[model samples]
Target: MTGVSFHEFRITDSQRLDFHYEIDSETEKKTGEIHFQSNIPIPFDPDSVALALSTMCGSAYRRVRMDLRVSPRARKVVESFLRCELSAPARGGVTPERRRRGNVLSFSGGFDSLAALRLMPDDTNLVSMDFGGRFSTEKPFFDKFRPTVISTNIVGTDFQRNSWSFMGIGAILTAPIHAAKYMTFGSILEAGVDNLRRLPLTSRGQTFPPFAGAGYRNAPYVAGITEIGTAMILVTYCPEVVNDSLASLALPGEEKLYRKYVLASIAAERAGLTVDLKEPPPPATRRPFGRNFTADFLSLYIRRFGGAQVRDAFLTDVPAEIDALSERLALTFYERINTTIMQKFPVELAGGLYERAAVAGLVPYTEDDWREYMIVRDALAPYHPTVAR
Candidate 1:
C-alpha cells in the first residue's frame, strides 16, 4: 500500500484500547490493541493515540494520513515526522492539558536504563512496555523500582521492523497520563553518534520535536556517556542488579564482543593489570556500520587497559591516519558530555548529574576541547564512505 489512514480508537476494556486503520484506499481495515495497567479507564488524548499508531505501522507506507481528532499543537508536531508524510486534522478546543511536573523514564531494566535511573531525579516515574512475554524475565528487576508496566503486541509483523519511532512511543503516550514534564530514555553515546560517518554529535534532532510538541521534553539521561561508561555506573552503584538484568539480546556479534571487552577492561582497571581479550575482535565491515559502539568501547578499553596490541586489533581495518583520528575522537566522545545537549533537562538536575558523573571519575571536556573535537571531526568526515562519494 502507498499510504495508511488512522480511522478510530475503541476502548475494548478498561485497560485496553483497540484501534482501526486502513491501508492506502483499501476497503478493508487492520486492527491493533494497546493494554495499560491502570484500574481506571485512563483518558488518552486522541492525538497521542494517533501518533503512537503512526510510529508502530507508518514506516511501511509512504504517507500516514490521520482522520482522528487532534489539536493544533499536535498538527504542528506531526510536521517533524520526516520519514513519511503524516497528516492529522486539527480539532479546536481539543488540546490536552498537562500541568504536573517531574519526569517519566521509559525504563527497560537494562544496564543503560539503570544508569539513567541513577542520573535522573529520585522521584522520576518509571514506565516499561512489555512485548507480550518477551521481557517477562526482567519483571522482578523492574518491580524493584515500582514501575508501571504496559503490555502490547502492536508491532508484531516483519513489515513494522523499520518503525524506529516506536522506541519512544510508550513514553510519549504515557507522558500525558503521568503529567510528566519530560519523557526520558536510556540512550547512550553509541546510539546517538554516527561514528562510522560524520559525527552528528546530537541524538534528539528527529525524536525531540514530537515530544516537545506534545508538551514533554525527550531527555536522554545517558546519551552523553558510552555503554562502557554506563556499565561502570551500574557496577559502581547497582552491582546486585548488574548480572541478573544485563543482557545483549539480538545485538551484533561485534557489539557483544565490545560489551564483553568493557567488563574485562573494568575488571583489569580494578585489579591494576592489563588484561587480554578472551575473544578476537570482529573483522571490519563497510559503512552503515553495525558496530556503532566499537569506537567508544575501544576508547574506554584503552583508557583502562592501555594495551597497544589490543587497541591495534580493533583498528586493523582502518588506515594509519584515520585510525589515529578515530582513537582521538573516540576518547573525547567517551569522556565528554556536550553541555548544550543537556539543555532539555532541568537545570539543577543536569548540573547535579554532571557534577556527580565527574566525581565518579568521568571527565567533562571544556569549551576549547569541544571546539577542537568539532574541527577534528570535520577532518575525519572526509574518510567516511558516504562523504568520499
Candidate 2:
C-alpha cells in the first residue's frame, strides 16, 4: 500500500456532491470521483465531509493526506476517527447545524438491523443507504420525515471492499442531510461481543476490538463534532439477546412474536410445508444483501484454514494450558494470514487490536489471548499482490 490523497469535495450548483481521490501505488495508479445526487437540500462543511470520505477509503493506504485545509476541530475529529492514520492541515472552527428530527435507523433490512428496528421506539425515523449499487425504496409514511436514500453507485470492485467504509460511515455523513439527531446501526452487541468471547481467534474482523471499539469512539466523534449523537444499538441489546452458552437468548419482548411464529409453524406443518429450523438459511442464489467483499475475503481465508482448526489446535497441543493455547492459537491464526489475503485488515488483526478490544468493556476475553496477525501478515508471503493494501 502507498499514499492515498484526497483532492477535493464539492457540492455542484446542480445539487450533485462530488468526491475526488487518487491512489498511487507501485502496481496501480487510480483516480476517480464519486458523485452523489441529492433530491433534498443538505448543508455540508467541505473539510468535515472530506475527512469522512478520506477516512472511509484511507484504509487501503499506509499514508492518507488531504489537499484541502481542515479546521482544528475537524482535524481532531478525523484523528480520533482514523486512529491518527491521516494527515491534514488545521485552522479554526466551523460547525454545521445538528438535525433535530430525532433518531434515524440506518436500516438494511438484514436480520440484525431488523431486530434493531423492532427494539427501537416506533417513532424513530428510518434512513436506508444502498452502496454497491443497491437502491433504497421509498416508503410513503416516511415522506413527512424526508427519509434519505443514498446511492453510492459502487457495487463491486477491489475498492468496494468494506460496506462500512461507505454504508456505516456514510450513514453518519448523512446526519447533516437528515438533520438526524442520532444515526444508529443494527450492529447487535450480543452477536459481535459474544462471538468474540466464544471464538476470539476466529471471530469476525469487525467483532474484534480495534474495529468494534471504533464504533464507540469514531461515530460519536463524527456525530458530536458534526452536532449529532451516534448510536450502536446492538451494543445496547447484547445483554438482552445472548446467554452464557454463547447461543441466542430469547428476548422477553419477542415472546409474543415467537408464539405467533410457533403457531405459523404449526399451520405450516399441518399444510405439509417443508420447514426445518435445523437447516441453514438457503444459499444465496443472488448476491446476499449487504455483502462485504473485504469481510468475505477474510472469511474465506479463515475457512480455508478451517475455523475448527483453531480449537483443534488448542485441544491437541495445549489441552491443560489455556494461556499457552491462547497464545499458540493467536500465533497460528497470524501465521495463516502470512499465507492468505486476510492481510488487508492488518491493524484489526494485530495484538493491539484485540488488546484494545479487551479494554472496551464489552464482552470479556482472556488477557492471555494472542493476536499478532498483522505483524505476521506484513511479513513475506509466497503469492503475488493483486491489489495493494
**Against the true structure, what is every candidate's RMSD?**
5.4, 14.1
Q: What is the lDDT of residue 47 in candidate 1?
A: 76
Model 1 pairs whose backbones collide: none
For all candidates, the clash counts are 0, 4
Q: Which runs in model 2 stand beyond 4 Å of their true positions?
A: 83-85, 94-101, 132-146, 162-165, 177-181, 189-194, 198-389
**Model 1 deviation from the true structure expressed as Cα RMSD, one decimal place:** 5.4
Residues 74-93 of candidate 2 have per-residue lDDT tens digits of: 55555555544657666565
TM-score of 1: 0.73
lDDT of 1 by residue, 134-212 (tens): 5555666676777776666554653247466676666666766788887778877556345224334453323455566
lDDT value, residue 53 of candidate 2: 61
Candidate 2 local lDDT, residue 236: 27
